[model samples]
Target: MGNLSVGKADSIPTRPKRPLKPILSDAKNVPRRRIGKSHKGRIALLHAIAHIELNAIDLAWDLIARFSNPSLPNDFYSDWLEVAVDEARHFTLVSKRLSELNTAYGDFAAHDGLWEAAIDTKDNLVSRLAIIPLVMEARGLDVTPGMISKFRAVKDYRSADILDIIYSEEIKHVKVGYSWFMFACASMGLEPKNTWQECLKKFYKGNLKPPFNIKARNLADLPQSWYI
Candidate 1:
């Protein structure tokens, strides 16, 4: 329960994800920019999806690693462990389907935007949950239906189906974030809603930009009363 007892992950007080080398991943062997849309497009998209899942792996594990403290209840590690497992499942599902699509992870260029948020929040768990699951991953929940439609429109049934499952599960994941965020605030005797907006402003340097899904934010238990 020591402040310094987070396990297994390379500790970082700043830029926790600066070195997401994916040492356990062989995605580098996968080809980049394969051709022909017959299955190539599906392959590329799934490749990107796999990359996301990979980043999610580190993100969840680091939660356990960076925040294993007496401030957290005994159950906190188990919750983050569950997240790690779920993200593993997601990566496997997308990777398997990507093979079916005739490509694999690293078969296309991808960004590390998701992990950037992870690094940004390494200073505190409340701010971590606020940005990771609430702001960023919550957006994943909001746009999933459209992703399904786009996949459907292109007739990639397997891709569409996989995305559907990820969509449904992501909601529960964000709910996990909301639950812990409130718990942290309540346990620390801080105002949950006020801290939420304050953290958002502090992290993003002001109001969150447009294209925000207020509905999904509400679903994540970010009540409108919290807006600054």
Candidate 2:
């Protein structure tokens, strides 16, 4: 539902009773900023990451709610719940950083690209796992190091430290997704690699950009052979 909230005290629903929509501009319409050494540029960078962390919080909850199935093991729910908590923490940290910069999450327009990917695979958990974690979150592993370096270069050690925490935890999140996606594929009598490739071709519209973080991805159990 439009008013759904996954607060700490909120109960997880069996499934969404109606369509849920979030208010955000399209990706193309959102303004892009060059994350330079300027204060405003740093604000813009942190603001964008905060927006992503906020969306990640919703995404973890949505995955649990939208695809609730009694047949699945309890570990599935537990994994996603942990992911939701991590996302919330990430959002809080980013928000604090933004506040320190004299800005906030909604101070700039943000694109709903992450949630759009969720919508694309809402009906299929396999596709959802493939696109969200393998493609999107894995991409985070690729780029987050550069973002950390950017902050450190500007001597914004506080922001860089926050990003360091996120970068480490995100690997575990991707591992959760990869593990469950393989589980789903096995349950369906499908080949994991081929099925993942098929899901990308069918549901995802973007390419897997390279210079990938092969080491981090491998640590997460996502081998380059699957995507590259």
Candidate 3:
């Protein structure tokens, strides 16, 4: 993970070098494994989530460094710095779990889909916020419950508990994204909903799959009208 100090936000490079440990592959090429009760299956699932958290750590710092503006408040930097700390913690937890399972993060290949959003929205702060936290991380709130239940059903309480923490904290992460996105919209004199829709259309390649966790989204202050 990158440095979590907000004081160094401006000094950090816009696009840092990618980690070389886990080999990256296309999403289509990455094999899909069901998170069944098998130990190996659990490892794969946790590894994938670790990869996401790792990328999230990078994304948060990149946002602070790449888009730091004199007009934006200090709260913006502190908010993303908090997110970076959370992501680093999440990755460390998952990596520890993987270690307990006799494996580690780089033991398996991971897809680079998460970072693609960053690459696509590199030039626009509003678009970056719209896509990464609002769209990408919000999707986590939608799907995490089912994942937690799966782990619980399989009697993997440790993993389930970890996911539960992630699920709860992720609501705040999405809210941070929403708040900042709205702030940026107001600053730029753009309509929030329309700008978000446009960014999704231009930058996001996938559809907004249903079965959304409306309750969680609501907790994050993300209106259903924006997505549905």
Candidate 4:
């Protein structure tokens, strides 16, 4: 597991536990963000984002452990490991912010959809890359600036600053996914854009809500045509 060049799907845990709070539940059951208007709502929003980061950490590692492609370059593992580190940092930053608000993670209910996305795409690396990074994390690009603004609007500059950092780093994470997805597509002789569309049609369970961050997505090398 320590060696990036060596990988075995069976060697890693199928599900790893973390110290997340408030217990996992259905997505519909989790509180919606009215994060700017009230203290408790803000706490709920942070808790939810923390839960997301924690799952993201697991997702990065899980991608490494679940994929057994011998043709995958060593840098694939390194990239995901870097993503895992970023997610861990994100979790710690958000958790610390939560504590500053006299709250903690697991103090609010969180949805399990992210892990479900992982499970659904586990059998295919292309689909995994499409759904998790392209669709899901890309959604982050769409929404995060507004979250930053919301935090700033309420004068929660500390929280806004943390989100600013996360937002910037996540673009690189998406680029890593985009690069690897293209690699896998080329290896299989499949057109990258078409295969991406096919994967999204097959495995993605939701629509991409609009008002997209075209600039951010472009920065990540994901063109507007991919989403629209």
Question: Highest TM-score: which candidate?
Answer: 4
Output the number of the lDDT-best candidate.
Answer: 3
lDDT of 4 at 119: 81
Off by over 4 Å in 2: 1-23
User: Cα RMSD (Å) per model?
Assistant: 5.6, 5.5, 3.1, 1.8
Name model 3 segments beyond 4 Å from true: 1-15
**Model 4 quality (TM-score):** 0.94
Mind giving the per-residue lDDT tens digits that candidate 2 earns over 1-228?
233333232454433332232236776655565567788878877877887888788888888877777677777778899999999999999999989888777877777778778888887889999999988999999999998998899899999999999999999999999999999999989899999999989988868899999999999999778988
**Order the candidates by TM-score, highest first — what do you get?**
4, 3, 2, 1
Ranking by lDDT: 3, 4, 2, 1
The sequence of per-residue lDDT tens digits that candidate 3 reaches over residues 72-126 is 7888988999999999999999999989889998888898888877888888899
Query: What global local distance difference test value does model 3 have?
Result: 0.88
Q: By the lDDT metric, which is better: model 1 or model 2?
A: 2
Residue pairs that clash (backbone atoms under 3 angstroms), model 1: none
| Candidate 4 per-residue C-alpha lDDT over 50-71 given as tens digits, one digit per residue, 9 for 90 to 100 | 9989999999988887885677
Candidate 1 per-residue lDDT, tens place, 1-228, comes to: 235344444554543443333333334644353323466555665776787788888888778878777557756777777878888899999989877766666545676667767878887889998888877777677667776887788677777888888877777788888899999888878888778877787775445545555676666666666542
The true-versus-predicted C-alpha distance at residue 100 of model 1, in Å, is: 1.1
Instruction: Answer with 1 or 3, whichever has the higher lDDT.
Output: 3
Error of 2 at 200 (Å): 0.9
